[model samples]
Target: MRVAKQFTPEVLLSAPRRGPAVPSPDGSLILYTQSAHSFDDNKTLKEVRLMAVESGASEQLADDDKVHDAQWIPGTRTDIIYLKSGDKGTTQIWIADGADPAKDHYVAAEYDAPISALKVKALADGSVAFVVAGLVGPDGGLFNDKTDEKKSTGRIFDDYHVRVWNELYKAQKYALWYSTLINAHGKWGVAGELQNAIRGTTLEAPYGMYDVADPGDSFDISEKGITFIAEDTAPSSPEYSGISHVYYVPLTSFTAAPTVRPRAIVMGISETKAFYANVRFSPDGSKIAFLHSSYDSPSDVRLYMGHTSSFGAYDVHRMIFGKRPRLPPKAFEFAGDSDSLLITTEDCGRVKLSHLELRHDAEATSLVESGVVTAFYPLQEGNYERLLVTSNNIVDSSLWQIVDVSMTTQARVISSATKHGAKYGLSHGMVSEFWYEGVNDAVVHSFIIKPSNFDETKKYPWILLPHGGPVSSWLDSWSTRWNMALWAQQGYVLVAPNIAGSTGYGVDFTARIYRQWGGAPYQDLVNLMEYLKPLPYLDHSRAIVAGASYGGYMVSWMFGQDMIKKFACAIWHDGIFNLPVFMLQSDATGGGPEFGGAPFLWSNGEEMEKWNPARPELLRNWKHAPPTLIIHSEKDYRCPITEGLAAFNTLQAQGVKSRFLTFSDECHWVLNPENSMIWHQTVFEWVEKHIGGKEARNF
Candidate 1:
């Protein structure tokens, strides 16, 4: 028998991660970026790789430390573009031929300023158009920091739009620059001048509140034009009203700007009340698709599609509507023809792929139902008859497969890392789930994770993990931040509940948390505890509850109610303590309608006051609060650090045993590998101190 390696925080953090796979135009090869963190070196290593579909063999294309965002140029085989440091140490566009690198592998273009979020499209006339995000000065031109220097260290803001997320507003703002790739004497290079798409406009693409720039998710380019999302700057204060609209700019001449201003693609919803995301253009350029979630009905996200003409006019219609049981639209892509599409939805506990016809009443049928689909690519070579997919489960990290368009056939696993789980003593048998009667006669779902070692006779303590988002759910998938298996390794059973407000169930169930944060969701959690009471294998007295974001908010809510006495201890990360104050400080802008907006302007006001955990009525229960650990990051603008500080101060003032942990360098989540290790160790030690799970900290 062989001894298996212990799955520690280091092992979990350092595991290799594959970025979204991009299939080649001909579907003969697939391109993706692979990265892994190394605690020994205190750095992350990355490589761009290409895998042949027929052979399951992959080869490294680029491994330079500077390489980032590698993308395939449309309409070409093996021709790629990526970002890397130029001669002046500024990020620039670099290109190479994967099949014949020796013939062409060099710098293709260099803008004076650093740029990122590259998107490329090949035009009908053999010309290539590309867009990149870079900092722009007040004049709407590329900002040259050396030339347009700001000497003042002092800052001033006259409005609520002072800062966004972690970054304080500076003189320059992020803007998208568009230019064409010109071929001169058998050599390719970007045009001499770059046109600012939103020139003279106060709008922003990939919006300020978005921590990362995912151009692909927010924008798409077709031969006729480009469509993108930009926040409406007409509002007096961006911090109070968060709404974005999709805009289309026709592209007839690469050298000249469009005659008309970027036309907003109307989705038939109020401009000030709708939230749009995941805008995409079909491969044939005949249709467009995007998701719309209204502020009035915040939880219900509908998929809408529109036909496009040559001049960018849209005949938009609601393609899919109504309360769906297994629907949580993540992303969609047009298949075979403009008549069919592929969508990924969160079903039950899993993120499953579904096939949908373009008609309004067409129902989606599950195509890949077993595991969570992380990413998918539709092969154009087969008229969209095949798909390249990447999926994972609770025990497995990465599983890549090739599936047919028809629902009758089983998917073929082209490449998988499932066997790698055995190296860490992980098996599928360790994971299980059950459904129970919850609050409001709803059937709530919960996933159960057990220790890898076999021993059903002994009773074990369990941990309750309520997921964040209030809108999100605990999917049956692998996660590095909150690894269920690794948590179970601490000699305790782990139960993750997809409560009332969670997605994947149905629209009504998801909308239950709105304006009643501590109502039905709380009752549902209590119901789960009641359901778990009779289990012979679980010790209810030694129970622990832990959550982050909205989950953290629930912890604070639990502190106010009589439920605090049931747990040995608790952990809350970036939770909302004072609801009204959070509306004022959060980047989400007035907490939207989820907290119930006032009939008259500028405030969440008294509507949010009722649900506040720090209200005078609820404060009386803090004295009896369980010994707890509160963690907050300085850069968490979504749930500002002030919320955590307020909770900690109130708990301490109430004489409750508690400790506060702060990470100044981290954002919403502790993503740095070193910081993650410290976080895991601290959390593990705290849990052990209260619940007597001493063997949990194997590291």
Candidate 2:
């Protein structure tokens, strides 16, 4: 029971912290991207780096101002193909061969029209196929040239007449050109113009199979072509808002005619309640894996695989299906040359690695029981014999290397990394799981992290940090630099709860928080505090509730409810204040009928009225609002700046200690390194002022 070296904030913030450590096909090299910030430039860039797997010698590839979507072309002499931000805000493809950085070449030129290339797959024939978008001019630019010519002529006429005809001709020319670009590259790109392009069938529908309006998810490319999962928002079934369907475009057809239409492969009706998770294709291009669940079934995400060729027919006989035992499947890998896969599942109590195999009848069998397999990776080019596994027992994010293949197997830890009892002393914190009965007696899962220097004899301040996606959960993993680790270093304990609406457990557990929003989920936060009040080491009198987005909404709601008097302060980042204003002011991109509808608000108007923090009357009724910090980005289109501004203003008007911080250029998530550092510094300083003593400042 000897403890190993603890992971520190510096180590966690270092390069190669997270993501797929996917090796090149040859296994001679490994390609991965790291998020780095240039102190001189003040920008955040994802730099692609290559590492020699055997020697562990690594070097940087081309540093395209911003690099993302990295893929290796499969062949004898493979090259890395990636997307680079080009001039005029376009993303062009660039290819690099060998380890020579200067030899990198840009494949496509910057197009006058907006274009995006997605999911590049190198074909056996030495050609790459990808999903691309060609944006046309605004308002069906068919009349653009004519209108420009007329505008020029009118300007000349106005110069001669001075004030007589300039105003009249200017208005007319502007109106004439107002007709947006209806067609681009022979494809209909506009939404409203019907005659410009065929609507339902002829012209590509906006919410068809290939178009993924949200950029958070990734698409897959196969030898057959490129496939993407997108939400089908056609008005025929308005209730099927978040419903996602698969679409495929043949490589040959796409190459022959770049404007070729994408074919719908698999379609499903989501009933406007569920979330369409990630879609991954099998190595053989014969099967597709995906997760699907709704609000009522939050914790349960059913993992299903289907034959690629047979779209609607999800024959379980040809694929494998399993219910993920944890809250979220962090990462998964298919075993090399075997009908099995390695999955990483995190529950509130612990993180587990599971070895799942597809039986002869395609049934999934779990190996290593529940807590044995903690983290796993299947060895390549061999039988399913060895795996890279990491495990934990509440206080450690232990990293281990396991050499095991079957269930009745013995695992030896090749290397060990722990959070305490090392040469350098313990620098990491422990993750503990706790659960309590929530709304409807539903079991709510959560994790608490005590600081590295935690002492059982001393009472420490606490911070309740909730995740953004009411569906997202906090797991047993190392902390990130952006995570509230700075607070922990200042002697504060952090609590992340899965509550009722988190994924990975089961569908029913996840769906409990649906439109109920301000009800059960908020109650769960208070319940967690009540459960933790008696803990000997926790200082319940100096607690603070904070979070971003949905978590921010929870903080705002908690402040209004007077739930916890011990809260000295609260921080709300990009949170929602008024659901109605949020619904009205927000764009049509993320929030639609699928998420929570405007009409549904009318049905539950009382709940909306009672919960919305933006209501002036509600703000006036606040008797004991905590000292609050409102942080938001002006350019944030997701939660919008108005929400944060309203909350800050209301708190200030009520003579409560509150301040507003806005990042002018940042989005919902701060990507700039300077701003991120400043944000962390501010939070750390705030926590230290309220909770940290001189001893806590000694790091």
Candidate 3:
């Protein structure tokens, strides 16, 4: 028998990651993108594949080099549409046969600007209406090429949207443009000029201004009309505040703009500023549903649904359950009945799939219990009785299954992870979970990942990985950025704690981190380290801790207090080192709310200073700092590069060992495959140098 090789960063990067699967019109086949890094070429390879849903067989449908965002052409079985990148760096639409994609032909005029997020639907007039998102000039046209050729290199922003997560606001804004495919003289091509759905307005289609991934479903199109979430362009509204609304644009003709202006169908409530996302219209165009969250209660995202009308007015309300599910939903899809939904919610470290009814006192029934359901799509074959569910766990990266709508644990495996696991020598038994009482007697949960070659009698150095989202939980899912299993394979025990601020535990637990960033959650980490110190299998003295984003913020906070003494070394990436500076210079507007109101607003800078790690008192203790690795990106506007530089300088001045690693082309996270390899290698070397673990040569 062939021995399974050890899992390495190279193997991890080479592993194929699947995108959201799109089902065919008849629900007999699935179309999805599989992407992986080519170490030899040092670039990502993407392939569009077609799969037989019933048999679980798949084949490549398009050239990976040039094709992307492929979708079934609404009403046809073999007909499909996708975007193709040209040699000149322009992206255009192409139509192809699912069986013979080699004969694909371009269907529309290529625009100067690139487009993405393709949505296709069949209109009533035997024509195909397609919508794509792309940047449009200030004049609401395709693109303003003159801005690219301007002699002066300057950007004048008089308002809040000077910069977002990684890039500055340009002359163009993202808008949804639509056109129809017409068969003229038996040759398929676009009918007329693309009509801008949000034309004559300052609104942007995608409501993304803060984080990397755009907030929610920016827009969805149906046979009747198009529904989209737009950024509130009112002078009073701030992009960082995440003020957005859902608007409905009725369909007139694909060749012309909407006869009537887009109007708000869903608005925020009185007290809290609302952020909307995942705006999905029901399979039948008669109804709509989406995920809703607010500034005050960002973690308590709930599902809201309403019926659509011809007059363009709709009453969308939050579905209040008699016995609410303890977990807040992440994403949801409407059932064929249009009155029910299949929602994936984070629950106690695992994402559960639940069935929700849309009545007065409805409750979500838990369907799938094991593994995290990352995405799910309802099949039209059984009147939406069956669903295509894609999930993963700590050990397994990818698994696709077909599950019925009923409450059952059984599912037919369509894509198994057995081969992938064996290839990398991964085992499910390596993962386990434990809980302990934390601050205020609140229960804190954590996942423990052990090395594949288990030896319980031997002591292993442990790595404490705090997740990024101070508001997010470390779910039981696979992640390329920070793969726990891969980390554990480096001859160490990996302990990922879901502390007070983490979701999936409860709303109260999640909200505890608010205004008390360094209080409950910090104590929870301290208590956790203390609890783990007594365990026989762990080398408590050689403990190493690392995190990114909010996790990095916590590491910075730990350096300020007695908690820094617990770990041998630390790694902080894109963390907020100085709260006052972060509030003023960060891309986010009014960055103070997460810190409990703006400095000039509610508390007059008191709230921002209360938990700041860079406060004068905290910096005095930097003399005893541990060996540290600081990683920040130049393009990161969220935490900004200044935060990293300031922290590193303080450590250096205090005679503490520290190093700074940064990527100019990357953002808040190191997404480039080569950069990621360097990141993993550097982190491992840092840990091995101080805590004594697997050497970089062995890795």
lDDT of 1 by residue, 504-605 (tens): 888888888887788888999999999999888898878999999999999988989998889998998989898767766776664455766542234555
Residue by residue across 1-699, what tens digits does model 2's lDDT show? 442243333333332332344445555565665565555565556567776656657777755546666766554344666666555455545566645555635453333322333344445555444444332344532222322333244344422111210021122111100011122342212222212121123222222222223232335656664445545433343223345555554444323432344565553443335544555667776766655554334344445565656665242222343332334454455675326666656544345666666664343344433332334544333345655454533323344444576656776544333323242244434446677777687778876777767788998888888777666666544444335444564567888888867765664666666666777788787687778878898777677788898888877777667674668778889998887667545432233322354423555465556657666665665557777778988877668889999888878878887778889888677755567666765665565566544343431
Ranking of models by TM-score: 3, 1, 2
- Model 1, TM vs. native: 0.93
lDDT of each: 0.77, 0.54, 0.77
Model 3 per-residue lDDT tens digits across residues 303-406: 66656773232222233553554567787777666777777778889999888777776677777777788777765532567788888888778788778787
When superposed on Cα atoms, how far off is each prediction in RMSD?
A: 2.9, 9.8, 2.8
> Model 1: which residue pairs collide?
none
Ranking by lDDT: 1, 3, 2
Model 2 clash tally, residue pairs: 26
* Local error of candidate 2 at residue 571 (angstroms): 1.5
